[model samples]
Target chain A: MNKNEIDNANKYLSKFARLTRNVLDEKELISLSQEKTLLDDYLQMEQLRFGFKYEINHSEDLDLENIEIPSMLLQPFVENAVKHGISKKATDGKINITFIKKANDLALTVTDNGNGFDTEKKNNGLGLLLSESRVALLNSIYKENRFTLAIQSATNGTKVSLTLSDWL
Target chain B: MRAILIDDEISNLENLRTLLEKHCPKVTIMATAQSVSAAVDAIEKYLPDLVFLDIQMGEQTGFDVLKLLPRRNFEVIFVTAYDQYGIQAVKFAALDYLLKPIDIEELINAVNKAEYKLATQIQTSQLDFLLQQLKKTDTHVSTIAIQMQSETRYVTLSEIIRCEADNTYTYFFLANSEKILVSKSLKEYADLLRPNGFLRTHQSHLVNPKYVKSWLKEDGGILLLTSGEKIPVSKPNKETVKQALQRQ
Candidate 1:
């Protein structure tokens, strides 16, 4: 293998190790910055694996280091997009993640350009199911700011958005 | 020892090759296949002593390849990335599996285990158990392979009443009043058993809802089991435990 490829591989290994460590951590909550770092590591590793087949973009409008949310709240949704959406597409797949401050709510969304699932049908995907329960668990823990999830899909693409009401 | 690598993804196969070359020098890679048909062909031709099999291919799985080769003359180690069902089946058989972005130490350990099993010519019943598990659609009827210090025990889910965490180890409390100590954390088993009606009522206690006799609301909540054991339920999980019990 080329030295560049080896370097990329090493980076992938270290990032993956950190991701595993973060996931296995027993902590219930983490900062927005820490969560972003987790997603950054995860997406970077995926980029190494998939290379130029897909593109990912990120945008945020919040104090990442100060605001805190439930740990691993967004990972499953991104994983769902990668596994069910872009991975199956032939080429030129795109994923966009946005974190926005809307009034008293925090809005996080992940959109992907791939074959989307039927919005009317109940998704039985394991990642989706796990995240659904996780949201419920979080709602139980922090009953103040109710967390709501909305998913929209069509044949061309899919978008998943989560709104933490009165969180900001 | 000779080995064959089978993965639909070229990069993963490459990664495995690099790790094997760097860490496991005792084994020789005879062939690599990317699809089920190719894997079957390579295995038939090479007749490898060991195989590193990927769980998911295009439309088929590695189990399909295993099914085609009925004769059990080779050792197998499964490699996959976040395949819950596949990993569950493999774990239930006490088989070795490496998750991708594969850890070098885990890869080395799996290789060493495969090498030793091949050398000893030990007939593994794990494959048969795994195949049986895959055949069964209902997980409730399936048996769980519990790895102990000296031997692996296969027991059904209903047989286990609860699990208690002791630091890095977990103790399995069975309905037969027998206890088995496993070297894995409570969190791991909690993940595996969550879908099967097990409740994580506390950080240190995982209870099977089937064995719950009654819920005691006093003393910060406790579950009375059919086995006459009182399992403590934590404050946060009390609501969940109550809901789960109500659903039963």
Candidate 2:
């Protein structure tokens, strides 16, 4: 095999292994600082494969560094946006992430400027379905309907927002 | 022994050739094919004694080639990455196969097994049995029926605490101090119960994960079950047993 082909194969294997590890590494919750660190690492990995700009915006009111949230909570939405939203578009795209501490809840919004999909359709794929189910499970585990996911899409772009009610 | 290598990837074919050359000197490399049609042509032309075949070859499957073969005259060693539902069938029939990212030891072992089986009379009915088992396992059923002398018995997989091998018969220990014996090998039940959270703790025992209360890690290992029964874990199976316990 040529050097380029071998390199590509090795790269794909490493990427696959990393993603599989991430998926299988399950826990109930993680500290907000640790979650941010993981998201940073994941963003670095995704940037290598998808040509899109990733931005992080957080509110100044809350101390997120010491907080804890459900495991694998926010990563899947970013992954879905990159895979279904930006990757399919013709030209360059941007993913805007916002972490807002509301009065009664902490909300995360992932907005992508690419081809918007039908929010009602289940077939946009497993990422959304899995994320929704995971959030529901987290809520059930917490013994309250505290976690909620909202997905909204327009013709120009799509937005997915997740809120943890009375989030700590 | 003449062998033909069939895989869609050239690199895998070359690697297998090297492995066979170094590990199995008794076998001669006859030819190689990279696709289903090519594999069929090579098999017909060379009439090899053994065929090291890959399961997936792009659009065509290795089964297609196996079906087109004039007769089941040669031994086949399947090489594949993913097992899915096919491996249960393969193991059920006692056929030889090597998982990819192949190990030299497994390669030698599978070749030796193929040789031993080829020397004896091959049963074509095993394939049919495997297909039947595959059909049954395709559904997401949690219960398995065991046949006794007069009538067939049924038990949910979760109801059984463990299975113990008594020669060809298997004894199922249930939660309510009930014991039932069935006329089937432990290997068959092991293959069936494996995907259902039952870990084969020893050659004679397969313990359910939910029923395992504790592991006494001395004398190989012993699992303390919820039913107050302790099952002995084999030496090599100790680490796996520990990992599974930790996961639980």
Candidate 3:
């Protein structure tokens, strides 16, 4: 797992959550979260196709209000890594996602041990562009808060990290 | 018999209400709808025996509403403007449809047919199936029937100038300086003809393509038919008439 994968995953989740919020009300969002296990099952099947093991870890008392994040934000990035990033690899790989609160900031990391890429030169497609726009919108709404993203990749794997102020 | 009246225009709704009350005393209007959502709610709630459906209502067509229903339990008598192609499709499908300013006689006849069909338990599945096929084939028609004197006459596909509602009867002005009347309301005609070439230029007038002579912009605009009859175009249909005329 590397920084670039973790960053991409966090970015994708933020955007997904925002888009889902626009389409659904609060009650619907709660129901959608209840189906997270179903999503996990789907992600597992996807991992099998990619010859990779998928794992997700979340802090028991993670403060959702502290982030003010959109709905279903990180799900897509995890999905994309399993489907597009890891599936193309030659051997078995692994994707690990971790969520933690550090002081007044929330940090989400997604790491995948698969094919790595040159993030400096590659242009993020529509998906990444959408993620950036949503994050910017989130920043505007939570003025005091800052959103940080870091993507790093090596020959072995990629890791992506996203940090947002607790005031989010 | 239970019936539902659907039309966005208040005048058309009133006219149909009057005609139904006078001619078909047995028909009790269960409800009336002025928009697609309201119509859907009405249809589901009332489940009337008959529905007086208007085809064109803003962005949503009558067909779109029909598609939303669970099943075709009620008989639909389409009320629309003069359009030859649509009339032909109705005829071909053996479905009952009426052109606008509805005549008392035609209204009575349609009601009688609906009643008889309902009484005999005549299956409308064939007509429904045919309509589906027509939609799939995209065979939209644009002609309407005109009742001249006592006999029903069909104006040619391209010869119709426009149709105007005069009380219960609709007058059809053709290219050949011939005027004919039909026993149906303008909403009925509008529904039937909207799919065809006839555009509802006003609440009273459904103008055809071949007979539009000129457009007068002054005093709320007027359309001069080829027959030189000046027809008052309503504000709502101004853009539609303009677009139809451009196509011609």
Q: For residues A11-98, what per-residue lDDT tens digits would candidate 3 score against the true structure?
A: 3443344344433534212212223443464565464356677777766655321122445556556665665568776356778887
Which candidate order results from sorting by TM-score in descending order? 1, 2, 3
TM-score of 1: 0.63
Candidate 1, B1-248: lDDT as tens digits: 89999999999899889878877999799999999999999999999999999998878999999988877589899988764647778876778888777867677888887777777666656777788888887765457888665556888998899998776688999998999999877766776787788998876789999999999888768999999999987654677788899999
Clashing residue pairs in candidate 2 (N, C-alpha, C atoms within 3 angstroms):
none
How far residue A4's Cα lies from its native spot in candidate 2, in Å, is 19
- CAPRI-style docking class of model 3 based on DockQ: incorrect
Interface RMSD of each: 9.6, 19.4, 27.7
Cα displacement (angstroms), candidate 1, residue A124, comes to 37
Give me the overall lDDT of model 3.
0.65
| Highest-TM-score candidate | 1
Q: What is the per-residue lDDT of model 2 for residues B1-248, given as tens digits with 9 covering 90 to 100?
A: 89999999999999889779978997899999998889899999989889998987888767678767666578788888655436645654545677676656678888986676667644344444434455573555455556454444556777888888776678888877899987666766776677677897866788889898888876646889888888887543566677887988
User: Regarding TM-score, does 2 or 3 come out ahead?
Assistant: 2
Better of 1 and 2 by DockQ: 1
Sort candidate 2 into its docking category. Answer: incorrect
- Order candidates by DockQ, high to low: 1, 2, 3
* Candidate 2 reference-contact recovery: 0.00
The clash count of every prediction, one per candidate, is 0, 0, 45
